[model samples]
Target: MPRPRRQTGFAQVTPNLGEHLDREDLLAALRAPDARVENTTLSGLELAEVSADGTGFSNVAFRGCTFEWVDLSGCTFSDVLFSGCRFVRCEMGRSWLNHVDFHSCSAPGLSFAKGRFTGVSFEDCQLSYVDLSEATVDRLAASETNLMEATLHQTRLRHVSLDRCDLTRATFFRTSLEGIDLSSCEIAGIRVSSDLRELRGAIIDEGQAAELIGLLGVRIKEDE
Candidate 1:
């Protein structure tokens, strides 16, 4: 049996200052070494194969942007807002995100392995087939989102709230789902390679547990 995780919460998470500038200068900054962009608002930008690894961005707002095959691995973001952004097959492994909010985004095939997210909220987003292996998330809120077939191997969830999310066929192997309450989310076809101990300390409603009877190999005999 796994030890019960302590109840944890994230408080006072806010974005810091950022540099307010145009789109061309932001592109130029990304090309420089140790680039750090802060307090900037860039919109309607289209980028492909952009490398944003290990860069620092603070209080940056991006809207109506599209990224294709872009690599954002190991990037650090603070108080950033992404609205109406479409990420197609982008790589975001080992990134650090704090106080970030994503709204109305379509992020399919977004690789986010080994990432750390705190005070992050996703609303009305489609995140199908996103890989989040070995990630740690705290104070994360997801609402009206679609996460079908998303991978969550060895991920840790703390103080997370999910509402109206569809998690059909989502993979969860060796995931530490401590302090995560899934009372209002739709969880169907969730594949778990490990035993039920991996779901210890998780809060689920009765209907959700009944949906997981097949995973538990339980045979509920009914009277004829």
Candidate 2:
């Protein structure tokens, strides 16, 4: 993919991708791992795969930033807004996210294994084949999002709302959906079992609904 045009904003330049960026630059700017960067805007900043696991950044804003193949696993963020950001095949395993909002972002094949999330929302984003296995999520909301062929193995989803989202060919092996609300998501070729009661609020097509019903003890009557 071609790089986006450089825009001016409050961001420090770091090394190219695959290289480690200096942490001093970020520290000198008083951008602590636990700092609150609310309402500030950052654009056109390309940094290397940072290893700032457990770093906390709240209320920061990212616009048009390209994070091509960055390893941002286990980073903590809250109330951060990301618009027009491209995270092509980035690794974000086990990241701690809270109240983060994403709009118009493409994050195909992004990894969030064993991560902890709360109040996270995604709108108009493409999340094809994303891996969110073993992640702990709370109050997760997705609207008009694409989640084709995503994996959610052993993930704990409590109070998650999927509205008008595509879940074609998604796999949910051993994933708990006790309080998840999939009322508005397309449930085509989705895998689930009888014990998973979260399907109460899940929306599905006729074929998909039949599959779920089969898992239960109910059988559809055929025309004689």
Candidate 3:
């Protein structure tokens, strides 16, 4: 038997500043009712065990921040940069990350279902178990990133460049992967389409070779 997933704690938490102070000193601030942060630079801060919902964060630089077991549902972030940040068991359903750059971040079990991202760059990031199902994005570039076990069902990926990314065990049900390169990627257990041969320019390795040969009407037998 496995434990069921619990809702993030930030849903019931909020940031409270006991004394009037700047955003840096506000790290010690208690949880607020809504936890709305604006125009704040919370760089290199460790935010743990907080579940946030409907929180609006804009123009924030969250470099090297550690967020664990956090939920950011319906939150809107713009011009935000998360460099060297780590997110563990984070839930960000329906959140909007417009023009946000997540550089050098490693996140596992990060859910962003039905979210919208525009002009976002996921450079050198590890995105495992990150669900982007039915999500919409524009100009999203993921360079030197790993997307192992990531779900991208029915997601719109236009003008998205996944250069040098690892896509092992990634799911792409009913998704269009035209004009995308996967040659520098690992696609073991990847869910693709019949026209995935068009992505031969992007996929690399023996597994893809075998699959592509099979798609090309070539048969390989144990005894030739």
Candidate 4:
């Protein structure tokens, strides 16, 4: 099989949305088993503790919506756009996302473990403490996002870009960073394996190199 195409730039998502749906209609659609909500737009809705597992959303746009403690595990999202949305403690494990774009969203403590992502991009999002463990990610781009203290253990990433993102104290156990660039991102206090093998073949600036060196109990002194 041919290799997957690399995603070099930001995600270009053009949702083919149709009629606007109110909160009641949206909730009703989500209640159905293996639901597939298509071509709809829902905005400015505040939902809490919603259980909508195994649902699929296609060509949907959610603007300024707030989701708290929502369970959306095993869900599928394709060609979906989330703008200015807030997801607090949302459970999205084992979900599959394709061609999804999250713009200016705040998703602190959002759990996406064991998920599969393709052609996804997050721009100007606050994703602190997000969980992405054991996830398979391809063609993903994250720009100006705050991923501080996020979990990425055992995650498989291909053609992923993290531009100007804050990865402070993020854990990456058993995850490889080969061919990934962290020059513009803040990677202070990132956690990895003791052998430091995860950082092999990864691109970083001089300052980042110094920080990694410090992890190996080595200090660099400037020339007199």
> For each candidate, what is the lDDT?
0.79, 0.70, 0.71, 0.88
lDDT for each residue of candidate 3 in 1-224, tens digit (9 for 90 to 100): 66333212111112331222354444323345445565655656776676664666666667678888877777887777777999988888898888788878989779989999877788778898889999997778777788999999889888776766788778887777776766657776676666663354443557567865665568778774
Per-residue accuracy of model 2 over 1-224 as CA lDDT, tens digit each: 76333222222222221322233554333334543333355766665554443456655677777787576776777767777898876887878887778888999999998998887888889999999998998878788889999999888888777767898878888776555556557776676655655455554556666766766768999999
Q: Listing every candidate in turn, what is its Cα RMSD in Å to the true structure after a full C-alpha superposition?
A: 5.8, 8.5, 9.9, 4.8
Give the C-alpha lDDT of model 2: 0.70
Which candidate leads in TM-score? 4
lDDT of 4 by residue, 1-224 (tens): 76334333333435455556788877886788887887777878899988994898887888899999889999999888888999988999999998888999999998999999998898889999999999999988988899999999999999988888999999999999999999989999999998998899989999899999988999999899
TM-score (C-alpha) between model 1 and the true structure: 0.86
| Ranking of all candidate structures by their TM-score, best first | 4, 1, 3, 2
How far does residue 45 in candidate 4 sit from its true spot (Å)? 1.2
As a whole number from 0 to 100, the lDDT of residue 102 in candidate 4 is 90
Q: How close is every model to the real structure, measured as TM-score?
A: 0.86, 0.73, 0.75, 0.92
Q: How does model 1 fare in lDDT?
A: 0.79
| Least well predicted 10-residue stretch by lDDT in candidate 4 | 3-12
Model 3 lDDT, residue 211, Cα = 61
